[model samples]
Structure formats: structure tokens, C-alpha cells
Target chain A: MADTAKIDYKNIFYPPGGILLWIIIYLELLTFGIALVFMALNARTEPEVFHESRMLLNTAYGAINTVFLLSSGWCMAQSVHFLKTENFGKSKLFLKLTLLGGILFLALKSVEYYDKVEAGLTVGYNVFFGYYWTLTLFHVIHVIVGIVILLVLGRTLSKKPETLKVEDYESGAAFWHMCDLIWLLLFPIIYLLF
Target chain B: MERTFNATWLVLIVLTIISAVFANLDFAYAALIILGLSFLKFIGVAFFFMELKRANVFWRVLLVAFVVLLLTVVWAV
Candidate 1:
């Protein structure tokens, strides 16, 4: 079993993935949070346009992407759990599943983007589309970066699972979950709410 | 521990579906309801999936506070 006694819960610098990773997490959240707040404030000025633009978004697509990220996050958490337990095989398996979920999410998002462009719902379409393109595209970029991180982690796990530090694994998982969390905020405000 | 992760994932999925359905309907507080559901999912992921529950209380409080601040701003605006 893993040495739970070694964990320092009270130490501010000893959270999972170390304090440095936590700093990155906080900064990323703050950045996205500001963008979202701006979007909300703009929505207040043009409620009707916001509402109509929100209506044009496909809720089913947003919801499906949400599920993909959440499920992938679960796989990530599981992969970390298995790593801690020294179950390298299961850990690698779950890691692959996490990658699959992320790839699927990006694939679906590409399709959605294609449809939006074909319909002329480009970035310059309106204030709402501007926010929509900016926020979601920024989020998509994060997801792509997250997938690259996971890919590197997966390669290490395959080649040298024993050398993979639990802290590093947790950091990757934390980053992936950040993507999911941002989507959680974005989907509701941009797709559901006016 | 595995069971806890499984349960959290299920709850998150259920909440996502509920919020999607809520979004499709018209009501006075539909926005509030949908945003509220998203809030719960956010907590679920942060605490369970992110394993912040195992971290210091400071981290937990910081995350919760961030979400609350975001939601409050979104709702008020």
C-alpha cells in the first residue's frame, strides 16, 4: 500500500503535484474566470443578442463534450490511483482511456467548429459569437495542451512506469481536470445561459 | 477509494444531463437551476476527481471560493 503517512496535508507547499503546479492551476483559473466575467458583463448590455446566440449553440454537443471531459477526468483520477497502488498495468490502461476521451472531445469539437464556420457563425458574427469563439477556442487550446501532457505521461508510463513519480502523475491529472472545470463553467454560461 | 471515484463520476454525469435538460426548458429560474447544477459538478470534480479533498483545507477553500465568486458574478450580471 502507498504510504499515506508521508503526505503533509497541513503544509501549503505539499499539496498534490506540489505548490508550483497549484500555482499554475490558480493562475489558469483566474485567467479564465476574468474572461467569463467579462462575457457576463457584456451579456448584460445585449441580453437579446446573447440569448439568441446562445440558442444557436448546440446544447447536445456541449453536454456530450462535458461528458467526454468528465469521463476522461475520472480515468485520469483512476490512473493516478492505480499508480499510487503500484498497479502499473491498470494505471497504463486508464491512462490510455483518458487519452481516448480527450481525443474524442477534440474530434467532436472540430466537427462543431466546422458547422459553425459553414453557417457563418464566425468570430466576427456578433458580440456573443466573439465571446463564444474566444472563450471556447481558448479552452480548446488548453485541452490540446493537456492532451500533449497526457501523451508524454503515457509514454513514460509505458517505458518506465516505476520512474513515474506520483506527484508528476497528479500534476497531469490536475491539469486535465482544470480543462474539465473550465468547460463546466463555459458550457453553462456560453451555451445554456443568455 | 475506487468506489468513491466511480460514484463521483456517476454523480457528475447525472448532473450534466440534468443541467442540459434544464437548459432546454423554459422557466423563471431555469438559468439559476442550470448554473446551480454546474456548480455541483464543479465541486464534484474539484474534490473527488482532482482529489483536493486529500489536500490541505486551504486548497479546498480556495477552490470553493473561486467557484462561488465566479458563479456569483455570472448570476448577478
Candidate 2:
């Protein structure tokens, strides 16, 4: 097979769902990137506080969450591909797999948060943990939104195929991918960097 | 798309694990190296998995710009 770059998605302006979706995605990506840069800059002021708090984090847990999100993004991408091909059953199967990944991601993230709370290291503990909890908890909200969108998409696929186009499915898929994209950026920023 | 997306996933996983290893290294540029690898992973997901490869140049330019700004900030800070 040729590279994906060679496979045309038809129009640049009319990507899967609509141009507006891409706009939202672009803004979302930029917003998260800026927030991350802000965190990085803030870390520079009190490097020790950030470092000490960062060390308390379980890199393994973050790594696991990374894997889960990555897997879910993969599944969601596959689902959209199958949906475009009009392979309804395969699409749904992959959608369910994506949902499974989302569930696991939330579960692991919950455990990580619980550890912090139990240790009296909540967001109020310090600036680093503040950004940590704020960013991660916001991401959790996004994942929850993604899951709900997927459920709505699932219902659409099963009950009313005619009401939605493949591009509409792509909108939801893109949102899920956005969550994955944000996490991809967030992981190294919080877990690996000083 | 399926084959390419699968290849993209493979690259993402490999880069992630490699960066995790880089974090354990005591090298001076480990942070930069990890960030660079992660940038590659970001490209993989955006281009292949997210289908931005075939997307219009608008998305490509905007996203690449976002990466540049992110890198600049992280590098400077």
C-alpha cells in the first residue's frame, strides 16, 4: 500500500465532517499547546517544586494511559475507515474497541488521581500539581465527552444510518482523535520533562 | 488507509517506548530528545491516523506551526 499522504480525502476544506470541525480541532490543539507551554514556563520559576512533585508521579501509570489512549485512537481511526468503506459491522466493532480503550484509560487515570489524593498531594499542594490536576482532569472531561459522543454515534449507526453520513461519523472520530492528540502532547510534558 | 494507519500506530508505540527509555538516560539533551521523539509521534498520529496527510495544506500548515511554537516554548523554557 502507498503512504497515507498519497490517499486523497477528497477535499481539504470539506474534511470528513465539515470545515467547522477542523477549525474546532485546530483551535483545541493550539489551546492545549499554549497551556502546556505555560506549564513549562511556570515550572522554570520554581524548578525544585515542579521536580519534586513530578517525581511523585508514577511514570508507569502515565505510560499505561498513553498506551490506552494510543490504542483507542487507532481503533477509532480504523472505525472511521471502515465506516467510509460502508462496512457497518466492522465499523461498529472497532468503535466498541475504541470505547474499551477509553474505559481503561479512565480507570488507570482514576487510580493515579486516587494515589495523589490519598497522599494529601492534591492540586492545592503546589503549582506543579495544580497544573497537573487541572490539565489531566480537563482531559478526563474530554475523554468522557468523547465516550458520550461515541455512544451517540453507535446509536446512529445501529438505529438510523440514513440520518448521518460517514463524515458525521468522522466528526466524532476526530474528536476522539483530538483527545488522543492532546494526551500525546500532555504525557511527555508532565511525566518526562523537568 | 488501514495499512497506513496500522503502520502509524506501530511507529507511535515504538517512539513512545524509545522516549520512555530516553527519560532514564542521564544525557544532557534527554529532555530535548524525548520531546523530539514525541514530536515525531505527534506527526504520525496527525498525518496518518488522523488523516491529516491527505488533508488540505491549511491543516498541515496550522498544525506544523503549532508544533513549532510548542517546540520553541519548550526549548526556551
Candidate 3:
């Protein structure tokens, strides 16, 4: 039998794998959930106030963003699968595709914000708008951070194709997916509920 | 072998589409129904696509507990 007792202790805590990374990703998710609960409770108490303010939102824009995030998550998952199989070239391609999705989401969000401003529906418009913009924008910022991480990871993977990149890529993808999952809740609450 | 087209995903998608269609119906609890369906879809995705079904028992319990807590809060509010 092969003796499997000689394990390296120095690198165990921050394993070359993604366990620590996932812990951080899940921590962010927990924070997002807490924020969501706080906002939802505030909205529940003032349905009419929130509804009137929610009218300022563009459902089409929200829907497009949702699609963008979902597709980006799919791309990220595909990239992880490719990386697991050592197909670094295909993995890079999928990562770039995912990055494009993130870029498109941000561009659409900017246009939506511009339209909201033109329609005189600023954050001060109402409490609902306040919460809506705050939550979505916070999620947008997370998306931007996620994209930056992906871009960096992409650059690294392209340079060192043989390195164990799957864990980092999967952790980043999980974080982005959490962002999308939150928005899926936020969209109907802030836009369609009214 | 794990199947490619998850029946859970298909069922959840159908439920979601139905819920969306029902949202247009002039019913008193249509919104509640939609929200419930959305929650169900969330569970389906979490368990299947996210591979939570294969997670450790403690993690699975934690997820269910959190979900129940959220639902309770929603109901209370």
C-alpha cells in the first residue's frame, strides 16, 4: 500500500485548493443576506410608499441585468469545468466571455441610472428608491469587484496554464453567482412587486 | 449516474413560468403565490445547480434553517 502519511503542514491552512476562498465567498453572501433582510423589513412596513417609488424603476433594464448575470455565471461555471479538465485555452476563452457579460451588465446599469436621473427619479425621490438604488448599486459594485478578480485571474491563467487555477476561478464565480442570486430577489421586490 | 437534464430544474422552471403567468391573474394572493414559487425555484437552484444536495449534513441543515428563518420573517412582516 502507498504510504499517504507524508503531508505538508505548512501549506495546509491556505491549501492550493479553494476551501479558504469559498469561506470568504460565503461570508460575503451572509453579509448580503443580512442587508437584504434589513431592507425587506423596511419595505414591508410601507408597501404603498415603496410601491409608488418603485414605479421609477425600469423593469426591462432589471430583466436585462438579470439575464446578463445569469449568463455570466454559466460562463464562469463552464470555465471551471474546462480548467478541471486542463483545457486552459478553452478556460481562458470562457473567462473572457464571462468578463464580457460583466461589462455588458455594468453598461446597461449605467444607462438605466442615466434614464432614471432624466426621469427625475433620484435617490431622494422616495424611501423605496433609496433602498432600491442602494441595494442594486451595492450589488453592482460587488459585480465590478468580481470582474476585476476575474480579469486578474484570467491574466494569471493565460500566463501559467499549468497552475491550479480552478479553485480561484470557482471562488470568483461563486461570488458572482451570489450577486446574481441576490439581484434575483431584489428585482421583483423593488420593481415588479409594485 | 447523474442525469444531465435535472428533473428538479425542469420542474422549477415550469413552476416559475406558471407563477409568472398566474401573477397576471386577478387573484387576491397572486403575489404570495409568485413569491412562494420564487422561493421554491431558489431551493431548486441551490440544491441542484449549486450542488448543495451533495453538501455535508450540517451545511444542509444550516441552509434549510436560514431559509425557514427568512420565510418566517417575510411572513411576519
| Best of the candidates, TM-score | 1
lDDT of 1 by residue, A1-194 (tens): 22333567467778876788888888988998999999999999999999999899998999999999999999999999998888989999999999999999999999999999999999999999998999999999999999999999999889887677787788899899989989999999998988
Sorted by lDDT (best first), the order is: 1, 2, 3
Candidate 3: CAPRI quality band: acceptable
Native contacts conserved, per model:
0.79, 0.60, 0.07
Per-residue alpha-carbon lDDT of candidate 1 for residues B6-70, written as tens digits (9 for 90 to 100): 99999999999999888888889998998899899999998898888888899989999999999
Leading candidate by lDDT? 1
| Pairs with backbone N, CA or C atoms under 3 Å apart (clashes), candidate 1 | none
In the range A1-194, model 3's lDDT, one tens digit per residue, is 01113223233243222346546645765666676677678777887886667665666676667667666666666676677667788878888988998999999999999988898888888777787778888889988898888888887788866654455555676666666666656655565654
Candidate 2's C-alpha runs over 4 A off are A1-12
> Candidate 2 — which pairs collide?
none
**Chain A TM-score values, per prediction:** 0.96, 0.92, 0.83
In Å, candidate 2's interface RMSD is 1.5
Task: Give TM-scores for every candidate, taking all chains together and pairing residue i with residue i.
Answer: 0.97, 0.94, 0.80
Model 3, which residues run further than 4 Å from truth? A1-19, B1-26
Candidate 3, residues B9-77, lDDT tens digits: the string is 356546645654654567877667666765775565555544455555555566567655764565456
Error of 1 at A140 (Å): 0.9
lDDT of 1 at A107: 96
Superposed model 1: Cα runs more than 4 Å off: A1-5
Report how large a share of the reference interface contacts model 1 reproduces. Answer: 0.79
